[model samples]
Target: MDKEFFTPRTLGDAIGVSQSSLKRWADKGLLNVEKTAGGHRRIGMEEALRFIRESGVTVVKPDLLGLGSEDLEVQEDELSSADRLYYALHSGDETRVRSLVLNQYLDGRPLYEIFDEDIQPAMARIGLLWHDEVSGITIEHRAHDICLQVLADLRFRLPRVFTKGTAIGAAVPGDPYTLPTAMVSTALRGEGFSAVNLGPNLPIEALLDEAKKIKPVIAWLSVSHLRKAHILRTEIKELARELREQNTFLVMGGSQIHKLRLDRDPYVLIGKNIHELVSISRGLVANIPQSSESKGEFS
Candidate 1:
């Protein structure tokens, strides 16, 4: 899913409107806007699509917003699903959420595809709603709980056919987000790895210690927050150096990873999404010789 948020200028450029006009719409409650901690206005992709649909605005530069003309058609088909799921989540309607998610899964979509194309985008929209003050913290928490439950259920249902190797994944310290790690772990498992997800807020030292103990084929660190990028870079570099010595590949990803100027390390793989992470994990597992003691199994 495209998880990009945009500035008014970028949105204006894409939709062929003046920035002042966009701001005016925001002020008139025609467009929803979120404010950053520093008070800069931000717009989510879903909201942009909504505005385009409702106002009959032509999106001339869809690529500037990580979308295409075809996406507008997709928006027409899937927007209602996303909208219903959002409202169901806010109202704590687990059954409806489950039915909607399961309908996609039962329609023969792969779990990873569902996560990347549907669930993640839905969550991103809900997150923006929270940021825009259209939803409360309780609603956000409830939505997360439902999402985790659905993911867990899907993980249990995935066929364990390929048995590649073992992988350990975690969110970095101070990054207390869970869904990204869960997505990584599920993607690894789908690729036939014995995946262990040490979810959110794990200190670097502790993660390194676990890596040493498990001797995994891949160690993944996900960073979702951009605050303290310098500290995270230092910790990640150290972890990469240590994992390199152990011949354990390190995979790092998340929305905020692009902000860091990381050194070029061949053993350290950077993934922008779950699909990339799964591809990297498959490649690493394929090239590395499995230890005699290592056996792949669901954990």
Candidate 2:
């Protein structure tokens, strides 16, 4: 049996919730689970964290598996759209949330509504809900996983010609949030570019190696979280300088860029949002006259 499939009763026990409640949630599709042949259900730690975030309820582990009692406390804060989405996520209603966004899109709702109203707010609340704790990390991972899944599903095919001179990439350094990178990748695909995503905590050397191999026309660096700003910036600056010599455009953005004062580095450009980034990329493609477009190979 795969170790990943090992039954996870530990999470439920940690939360002090009855197996029945968890099963009921799974049945309603409000909780996600996996079942074994004998009909035993298993849950994920991510789902458990989401549940705690939405409920804002504390669980005091009177017995920490074998150690002493653990006291868990929850905090109250003014809820935002992000929090509402967190609740939905904890409830394991990915389908419902996706349906709502898709329906709005079909009804001619603006992209801004889908992002600003539907997605961004939900992200904010998730952050606040998990401000501190190991469980917060679990919620963070779940949020990123769900967002990436949604973005992948939304990426439709593009015209063949549009792929001739364009490339896209995503990187998370400086504690950047995952949603922005995933969101930008989706947007880039929608605009007819081939995108490559190298997720969080990527080392600078690995980034350089990948870029050299893939040789993307442009790369995106997201900085939603600022915890590692200086270190990430310094490494990225060095990489950008090196990559520029090879003719790659390094673009960056996220909350940190907006808040911090970063010096001008010609090789690096910051985008305010997805629209700006796409427009910039399109311009880069247009600059390379038709005859020059065929030289760069896509990986």
Candidate 3:
């Protein structure tokens, strides 16, 4: 994809700063810029967005940067965040929902909060709608599509992870849900881990095969749907052992995983939510021994 670039003057105007100030900041390395063939300076859209977010600058004209051209400020007078999100998902308002979520992240809210606090509650309500009415199933399916679109956009805006420790994750076999595993990868990326999401319904063999190839620092499994309890437990036990042999930690989560025998150990970790997943993963990445505090949520 071609990168979008903005001139110093355009960015300055958008943020209500002068062209000279922008140029000076660029020269001082406060802002990143590139030179055109004609020797004029240009800032990539990512850098411009970064400056706007980190500097807490009010975008007077977001159109100049190809962001939300409409009102970006979230309306708080009428509905709660989760309620508003539910309405958007049910109504299939992709643009509005995208604005709502992307703006939250740009405002410094962590991805876990967006998942645990906003998307979780909203999706819970949506799950009910999937069976309540005739059009409910269609609405639910469309909502998933819209959510996937928004997630792709959000992932693009996430700062590229360049540090060490690759992490691989996937939804358990027979689990078709996409958001939980995707959210895990995104959250790990935010914490500077090279997260690789192998996607849903991935076989245990594939996960083990990939783990052997990459030797990821952390391997994650999300259990949103359990097709066969006995087989899945056996697979998870084996997966945990495979990871432990490589000195890798296994992190697992999702609502349907409670039935599994969660064990308290150095290499096997279970979480109730995305925040715990991040906490555990980062601890392992930093080699911060949490054996004292490492206990499963269901053990």
Best by lDDT: 3
Stretches of candidate 1 exceeding 4 Å from the true structure? 1-84, 131-134, 160-162, 295-299
Residue-level lDDT of model 1, residues 58-89, one tens digit each, is: 66676675543333334446566566667767
Q: Lowest lDDT 10-mer window, candidate 2?
A: 67-76
Better of 2 and 3 by TM-score: 3
Provide the lDDT at 270 for model 1. 95
Q: Report the Cα lDDT for residue 139, model 2.
A: 76
Which of candidates 1 and 3 reaches a greater lDDT?
A: 3
How would you encode candidate 3's per-residue C-alpha lDDT over 24-96 as one tens digit per residue? Answer: 8888988999999999999987788777778777777766766665564445647776787888898999987
Candidates' C-alpha lDDT:
0.78, 0.60, 0.81
Q: What is the C-alpha RMSD of each candidate to the true structure, in Å?
A: 18.7, 13.9, 5.5
- In candidate 2, what are the lDDT values of residues 1-299, reduced to their tens digit? 12232234565575677677767777897766877779987654334444544455444452432212412112224554345456756555666445444333433444445665667767666666566777776776677677666655444312222464445555554454567877776666545566766766556687788788867777777776666666766777788888898778888877677654567876687888776776776777677554455454443
- Model 2: clashing residue pairs? 30-91, 82-121, 82-122
Instruction: Provide the global lDDT of candidate 2 against the true structure.
Output: 0.60
Runs of candidate 3 with Cα error greater than 4 angstroms are: 72-76, 288-299
